[model samples]
Target: MHIPDGFLTTPVWATLDAIAIPAVAWTARRAQSELESPDDRRIPLLGVMGAFVFAAQMINFPVGLGTSGHLVGGTLLAITLGPAAAVVVMTAILILQALIFQDGGLVVLGANVLNMAVVGVLAGYLPYRLAGRGKARSAAIFLGGFCSVAASASLALAELLVSGVPMARQLLWFSAGLFLVSGVIEGAITAAATRAIEGMNPLWIREARPARPVTIAVAVLGAAGLLAAGIAVASSAPDALQALLPGSKNAGIPEGRLTKIVLGLAAMILLYAACVIAGRRIARQRSA
Candidate 1:
């Protein structure tokens, strides 16, 4: 679902970038307020979740018809880390994917973040919250995850149409069809992950409190390790959009096994540090 460069015109991406910058900043502020403490577990959990999402996205599952889909993780992050924190985590993930791995284009990075992090997370989470925790929460999570991917894909398709890309109408319908299958896969994953996390440590998602430094270290390290491992096993299959629209020219770093591990680790570490710093700064600002 990463839109490479040249898919969007300059003006379209620029306008989205303009909107995304402040929106992410606002989310950061809101996350700090909601977490309510500099040492809140959600702060470190953001790092952990970001790493997990980044790694998960690398491993694409076959969705039949020669197309593949990967976990977007936006809805899962929102359910676990709160919507605002999910946005911050996703923004960091998207930026790293663009700058380090070149998985996404720098020009369209803003639009990617806007669609996946801001719109996707919020669209998924708001309804989940409205449904409330119970038997319905699981269903809500599924719906939320499904909607997140569908909404993000819709936005991306709309961007392509508005940008006047060649065969935009055909691409829109094709991509929408692909998302229907992908969204169901995403929904199931989101529901399963939420259930597992809730069973293991409900406080991780529900309460805002300080986590032990060692706990944070272990969580972050575990996620980083999984990211490194996942990169090695990631399928070479093209993602849905790539399968539908080939011949994109966005270049990325060579992905040797060692290079993938190294880059994945580096990206996770950078994300963890950035989220911690951002959380701290927001905490200080809130106190003042």
Candidate 2:
């Protein structure tokens, strides 16, 4: 639910921007602390998880009523990385989506970031932190995914309403129902994905064991395939926010569909390279 420019009032976006800036800075420090470790594995783990979240957000499925839903990946990141690190990954994804794709708007970037990256990740992580290690771990994870999307979507809807997006009360309730359906789907996807990851490397999440290079490669490659397939299969349905703006979607994604796809691919490559470089730097610093 990336809020584009001109959708929000100046006050709404400005207030969120003010709150998001210091909040992100604080989270960055916390992420650094989470990454500070002798294991070295934690370094690459950060970027890999970021890529996972990035790719996950790309593939949207139809959820009916001229709207679509996609995996938000907040809880998954929180489960794999700590809440602080997850926030950092999500923040980077949102920023890149805004810049490279104009998938979101610059002026309102902070509002989107706060909704999806900060509160979304934290809201999802709360349940897991409470009951993840016990037998209720499965339920906790599902709820995490549910809460992640629910919280972000709820905030987006509320903000849009507050900013005078002009939805009838019925439409508002309809949007809420759509969001709830999406949240349930997200919960299921998250739980299944987490289970698959744990099956492959249980210690990766809990103990920070190094993920095999091959596993990461396969996952990234799979995501790439999905991205390609998504372009074809992804519904043309407007998302909840876009639905309100009627006839306002410009050129698939502000620069033609092909251009957006190419940039997305290129951005993924840059993310991988940046991660490798940063991971090496962190590793060296810790070693010395």
Candidate maximizing lDDT = 2
- lDDT, candidate 1, 1-288, per-residue tens: 778888987877898789788988887988888876666766777788789887887887776779876778988887777778888998898888888988879888888988887878876775465453444557878898898888787677657655655453365467668788778989987787778788998876643223235434434543443353234223221233333434532546564556645665687778877845654444344334
Which regions of candidate 2 deviate over 4 angstroms? 38-43, 58-69, 207-288
User: Which residue pairs of candidate 2 clash?
Assistant: none
The Cα error of candidate 2 at residue 220, in Å, is 37
In candidate 2 the C-alpha lDDT for residue 14 amounts to: 93
- lDDT of the candidates, in the order given: 0.70, 0.72
Query: What does candidate 1 score on TM?
Result: 0.65
Clashes (backbone N, CA, C under 3 Å), per candidate, total: 0, 0
- Give the per-residue lDDT of model 2 (tens digit) for 1-288: 889999988887898799789989988887777666756566677777778777777887666778776778898888877778888889998998899988889999898988899878876876565456545678878988998888788777667766767666468668878788878988887888789899999965653223335434533543453343333321222243345444647635573556645765676677756745553444344334
- Which of the numbered candidates is closest to the native, going by highest TM-score? 2
Q: TM-scores of the models, in the given order?
A: 0.65, 0.67
